[model samples]
Target: MERDFKMTAITMAGLEEVLADELRKLGAQNVKEGIRNVSFKGDKGFMYKANIALRTAIRVLKPIKTSKVFDEEDLYEAIQRIKWERYLDVEGTFAIGAVVNSKNFTTNSHYISLKSKDAIADYFMHKYKKRPNVDLKYPDVKIHIHIHKEWLTISLDSSGDSLHKRGYRSATNIAPINEVLAAGLVMLSGYKGDENFIDPMCGSGTILIEAAMIANNIPANINRKHFAFENWKDYDEDLYFVIQDALLKKITSSHFKIMGFDKAPSAIKKAQQNIINANLEEFIGVHHVNFFNSKKEVFGKTTILFNPPYGERLNINVEEFYRKIGDTLKHNYENSTAWLITSDIQALKYVGLRTSKRVPLKNADLDCRFVKYELYEGSKKMKKQIDIGE
Candidate 1:
């Protein structure tokens, strides 16, 4: 019945291979990628590290059981078999989140979760005569059921909340990107410790913070307040401290520049506050300046990664803003690899530059394209007619 004898499953957001790779670097063994989650084998200490350090993982789950269920009846039986007393007491509250992707279970995820909840409640009612209450917001025990075809994998949500909540940002402007997605974008850009990084529209300084951590080889979750491992019944304090110390020892000094720019003074202030909150003020700088008016930095091999306003939620004129972005990148920034993520496919074409690479990425419900443009100082790479009509 020892916790170390059981296997753990770490769940992550989908299409975030770079984030999965980051998990592997942190000493997670048997790291495997699925649709929107990664399954890795680790002990309690590694679980703590995964919750604290994984940038792209939404939550880490310690899977309790996997079974073949043909119907809801079979699902109930599978749930009833597990010894839930180890994870939750009769006084504690619990919640079930079901993610179904099978032909037999064609209903919505909510309905599947309802059935699983009923099974757990019935089991506790029969055994203890008083079942645990269901607390959706803050549950003592959160269960995850991922049904793929006939296989149903039940896991305990080790991370109560998503790992993206690093507890740094106190404010957010319109259309702020998720911290995990921002970190993934930083990783995908391949900007290591060698180059200067800039986020012109760095709302809340998420990209700049993530970039600084990546450049300095710092643990992503060092600023976070809590991890699921802290709540575990068999938590090992000494082992967790050792892992933390080892990761801290690997931190290298970052010599590269990480700069942020925002036209709004309010955004700049918020970004600076968040940067300071993360204890990265010494490594990062924030300034209030319109990106269109700003030129490339003095460093020739600079990398600019940003999430510009898409005018989807904001009330900006899309055509003019897109034109200005293209104008700024083409005229001011040269000999740099500039990348921006935008969900508007139409607006991306208006950039007026040949895209070196067009990567498919998702921003919540919006399917976005992460496009890159290589700007050269001379006319050698500039075509007579730089077409982006396609």
Candidate 2:
């Protein structure tokens, strides 16, 4: 059995707690939350499970070494000291990425990456006659450099591409929510496979797809093109397949419906294509209709989660659009819990509904809030809408 070691699961800024809970549930030991990450310890099989099953994790990194650095030489020497041969061969290709949050670094991420790359190549060249070539796009090894103040940590990225590229989305919108964020929202909204899921402003059906995947307990990265760990020298292909097979056995179908709506023909078409790509056609349906003009498709309780246009990307009047959203929820969607993630705080006031909960989150570079509103069954507005009876 491989020895257990600490690993960090990178996540969206506000989802640290949720991701930590996920790690705990996945059987990680000594789980701890950081700003936009969580740390835990597990063996190789568990690491494979994490990359495959962690819905909120953007990437999982196995820390190989940690050292204090006051300057660039310290960074280079610490990196060179790690036995890179243990993870990658001299002829193999590799890529480096940096996430530096330190004053001592005093350089752009690209510069850090280049320095790390050079250190690795030089280390290999001194030992072996030839050195590994840098393949930025697709590499046999992916290294992550994290610098915090004077501390430098080098890690091996277990998940190659961002896990958000779940190998299912062939189409996207102008500002589609990141899949990791989408999944985190669904998880945070308290949706299990038990309730009906709806996305009114479903741009390309990301929320809907993530909801269905969660509902079915589907492994988050089951459709990923590849995981970087698969290329490691110690990679156990059979062990990985065993983990994948185990995850497959856990999938269970949900009885409730999952649906999406978008007024744009382009969005509707792309959503359908993406939903098909996810193999969730039976559980999800996309329709072409303006959200404000539509009512809840389900009769009983429903959970609606979506990312409406934040107005930064489009020319629409954000305030009025938000008002319509509030009106639609009040009149149309009774007995429902509606949540939306948006960067527009001022526009949120225009919605007019009292937010039951507000979660501060960062979407890409934008500071956003995930707000929730409860629609009571048989409220005055619902009664009025039912009286008018559309």
Candidate 3:
């Protein structure tokens, strides 16, 4: 590969800038942030590194071609014009996912995917005697179509599954945070291998695992079995191994502790299992205890990041729960910076502590707020003045 081909990365909504900053740190060229996506330039090895290291990206795509399409016929013609034989064999199973945003095209994405699949199958059936099968669960080849108005961009999904499948999480209970979001939260918190970290409300240890990975400089996908590049026609195993070895060599030993506390014993068991699965048992410790009654005693300059249960089921008193969060942090965790994410805006007001930062984020489909509070040992007003050099 010439190392100059353009690549696109898709991310969760409102995380395009986050993904773009990550790519820039990885030395990607011509980085541009779009809505829920980032475009950059890299080679085959860079593609592998991006898959292994990126924390916010969902999938990395290599655009094969971009053109204008008016209807299904145009879509088929464009898909067929790209020599599919170069990328996959007639025996390989494949799947297509389409995203449409056009006024004239009211066709469902599933139908568009089916039409594109037919075009590929027909192309192979006409050229060869056999056609590939479609495997939705796991496919050797995955194609993506993006139609915006009249423009169509067809790309190959280099990340077969979503990047959130970091390969370490086998034990999960209710409300396990997404790996990418967890990593992003750690990044946004500005805790870089310094200070003790605690996810006091850790349900399945997702935040703790992500924090340990960041602190130890481990590759995000170190335990992953396969990347989509491994299935690419031009995959260079030796080059990939070289890159992997180099990345592994950079893994530093972490001395800081990452602790998780969950009130439910079942949640603690799942967290411990997940930590062990990630080979990070030494770095992370999980305890079964209610966070509201717990105090910060992790030693110097602790950073707490947690996601408390936002009452969506309408059974729990959300206002009271949030108020408890404020009381616990203010009374117990002095000299600490605590951050929490919740979708309940009404409940957030109950946590009466002044938020130092209010970051707008989304969890699943729910618009959420990621707020930070600075707990002080004495008067918060005096501490604020001291912090501001007043």
Q: What is the TM-score of each candidate against the true structure?
A: 0.91, 0.95, 0.96
The TM-score measured for candidate 2 stands at 0.95
* Residue pairs in collision within model 2: none
Locate the minimum summed-lDDT window of 10 residues in model 2: 378-387
Candidate 3, residues 237-291, lDDT tens digits: the string is: 9988988998899899878878999999999998998899999999998998899
Q: Order the numbered candidates by TM-score, best leading.
A: 3, 2, 1
Off by over 4 Å in 1: 1-14, 382-390
> Across residues 1-390, which tens digit of lDDT does each residue of candidate 2 receive?
578999999998999999999999989999999989999999999999999999999999999999999888999999989988998988899999998988887889999999999999999989997899999899999999999998898999999999888999999999888999999999999999788889998988889999999999998888887899989988999999999999999999998988899999999999999888888899998899899899976867899998988756758877788899999998999889999988888899999999989999999999999999988877657657886985
Residue 103 lDDT (model 3): 81
Top candidate (lDDT) = 2
> Scored by Cα lDDT, where does model 1 land?
0.81
lDDT of each: 0.81, 0.91, 0.89
Decide which is better by TM-score, 1 or 3. 3
| Global local distance difference test of model 2 | 0.91
Clashing pairs in 3: none
Q: Which ten residues in a row have the lowest lDDT in candidate 1?
A: 1-10
Higher-scoring candidate on lDDT, 2 or 3: 2
